[model samples]
Target chain A: MSVLSLISGASIPVQLVMAILLLASLFSWYYIFLKVFTLRRAEKQTAEFERQFWSGADLTDLFQRAVNARDSAGSLERIFESGFREFTKHRREPGTDVGALMDSTRRAMRATYQREMDKLESSLSFLASVGSVSPYVGLLGTVWGIMNSFRGLANVGQATLSHVAPGIAEALIATAIGLFAAIPAVVAYNRFAGDVNRLAIRFDSFTEEFSNILQRQVH
Target chain B: MAAAAIHSRDEALAGGLALAMHVLFLVLLVFGVSWQHKQADTAVIVDLWRDLPSVTPPRVEPPPPPPEVKPEPPKPVPKVEAKPPPKPEPAPVVKPDIALKEKQDRERKLKEQQEAAEKKKLAAEKAREAELEKKKRAEAEALKQKQAAEAEAKRVAAEQQKARDALAAQQAAAQAKVVDEYKRQISAKIRRFIVLPPNVSDAAQVEFEITVLPGGEVLGAKLRRAANSTPAYDAAVERAILRAQPLPLPPDPALMRQFRELNLVFRPKD
Candidate 1:
């Protein structure tokens, strides 16, 4: 059977499966692109913030800059600003101990790091689901299509290969489409997950280093 | 700030490129454009070595039995009675010499007769032996000729059989081809004649058998099987078969026999 006929001749259930797989593939690709852009931006902004923070810029100036950027501030810069703001706020209170100031600052930085990691890891689960489930869905369609073809065979007095082949080819198309949807999603998910993990590690290390620096200031 | 703007623009560009690539991929898939690979046509290689006909050698005829030798009858011998010595020669002292000379002459004649008889018997024995040798040679020659004739006859018969087998095979293949063509023509003619009733909406198949004469006239048509169809549907199919009269048959009488009784199936929804 020709590829055109295989697809056009598919039964209703198989066609529906193919349509769902195509949509899933399209959306997975979109997320893949979006996540790539988001991760790259996050990495770039983190690097830029690190460079500025270590350039011997005054702490107050860096904090003011981060505050000015508001929601647009990078995750690392936001963590720095939040911790510094908490330190300053508690410092103004009479009889505030150095231990309490450091505790509050570290806690705030840790919370921001968690929020940043969550944002970076968003939409990855969808890619994972697409990769894992599409094949079975396609399999379901293929089984149904084959059952229908065999059912047709029962009506025929003599079953020739020509009678059954087109139906089978149409059925197999679903599996092909399923694999088409799955392979790329699986590969992209793996790569993105690794990238997000690396970013998370960087954020954790940055928070620890910032806490140590603040601890030195308190002394 | 400039870096931020460039970064956002780059993000937008990446997203746009990704979207464009995905769209292109999906379009290629739906249109079945990118999956084209040159499918190499498989060449069918016939093995002539195995298909060559094997030639069988003719059977050898056994040698003919030896000719019987017949004994010749003995020739009749002539009998001579000894004559009584008639009168003893009266002793005549004077004629003794004459008597002795006569006896000597008689003994010499007898010896000459016995030698002639012995020579005649030897010549007859030699002639008999020569005749026996000639008969043996003639028999051998006749046997060789007979065997050669038998072998020639066998070889001719085998060749004739092979030719007949080849002809039969060729005829069968041609007959099959003609039958297929005849079936196709009949189907086309029937389909052309058929005007399906509009009210018959269900998917139905009407199978019927048609009997045609050698001259291509439709003798009779009867419905063999009916499925999801009414009597009207069956009647229409039968009528169509009848209308396609004389039903294009192969010109060969042998091939025409195939269409004499034919089972045809008609599917309304096909």
Candidate 2:
């Protein structure tokens, strides 16, 4: 029998398990591509904004451009814009305490950083869950299918390889598909997770340096 | 704005690529497996050498009897009659034509020599008339010797002709016997496969004209006529003929040609 016929001929639970793995694999692949593009753009934008900020560009000029950019600003740019806007607002208000002003500005940047991290880390948990769970689901189907085949063997007077082979083969397809679904999800999850972590670290260091620059401006 | 729009649009592209990839994977799996199955189907090889080497006992039977009977008969014929000539005769019984040509050529040369001697005798008689009576007696003796030699050659030629006729008859008889023996062997082999029908008479016989290949495979078996028998018996005989594929025939191809198409009569009791 062909693999397709064998798969179609499998017991209901096994087929269900296969269907789940296939869907999980497809979704993982989609999330993988989505995260790739999202992280790539985030990294490129961070590099570009960092270069511009450090290029001896005027703070007020960069702030005006970032404000004009608004909803379309990158993660790091949005963080910079929010901090600078808060700094400007407190500076315009007379008798505002310098330490409190710096504290509120850092708070604003921290909130923006949290939002950016959320966007970069989106769908990552789903990838991690699929990678961890699919193999077990496939194993469960295989075990159940093998149990059913052996149960069927009780009625037959002679138990032969031919009697048991198709069932075992069908059952094993679940495990094969399970590994198929899990391997890439695991690999992509590991790679993308590392990338997001590195970006997170870069954002953290940027916030610290930005807060220091703001304190100097206040003095 | 462009970057944000492009980023938002990429989900569709990613989903399409993922779906296309899965479809490509499935096509590879399905076709790859089927291609492998096809390769396995074509790999099965039938060894013809297995069939060719085991020349069965029946195939060994027909050739020896003909050669043994054929060579023995002709040997005694030449030994009995050609003893008087004492000439070095090399198997004249087997090769009568060559021996006959050699004898004729020798006789011609003897006659030419006699003619030359007669001419010389006449010339000498004219030259010496007193010795004419002696020359006539000598010529008469030479004529007597020539007549005896001619008679001897005629007797030998006649004996050779008689031996040839006997040898041809013996060969014909041997061939007929081998053909009959092969027919019996074929009938016996077919009979082994016959499933005798119940209530069929021992007298009932079915005749079939069967065509066979060189390898003894029965190409076709046709009922020449329905025996005064039931259809079940006819079917039994037909099945038997088919089962007895490659019916036993003489190994000699010349003899085998006689068996290519045979009208076989099968009787249940026989």
- Cα lDDT computed for each candidate against the true fold: 0.78, 0.82
Instruction: Categorize the docking of model 2.
Output: acceptable
Error of 2 at A133 (Å): 0.6
- Chain A TM-scores in order: 0.94, 0.96
lDDT of 1 by residue, A48-105 (tens): 9989988989999999999988656788888888888988888789887888888998
Candidate 2 clashing pairs? B216-B246, B217-B246
lDDT at A146, model 1: 90
Model 2: per-residue Cα lDDT over A35-127, one tens digit each:
888888889999999999989899899999988887667899999999999999989999999889999999999999999999899999999
lDDT of 2 at A81: 92
Estimate the lDDT of model 1.
0.78
Q: Which ten residues in a row have the lowest lDDT in candidate 1 chain A?
A: A1-10
Task: Output the lDDT of residue B260, model 2.
Answer: 85
Q: In candidate 1, list every pair of residues with a backbone clash.
A: B216-B246
By summed lDDT, the worst window of 10 consecutive residues in model 1 chain B runs over B49-58
Tens digit of per-residue lDDT, candidate 1, span B134-216: 67776776677677667766776676677667766666666676577678777878888887876775678888888889877
Question: Alpha-carbon error at A82 in model 1, in Å?
Answer: 1.2
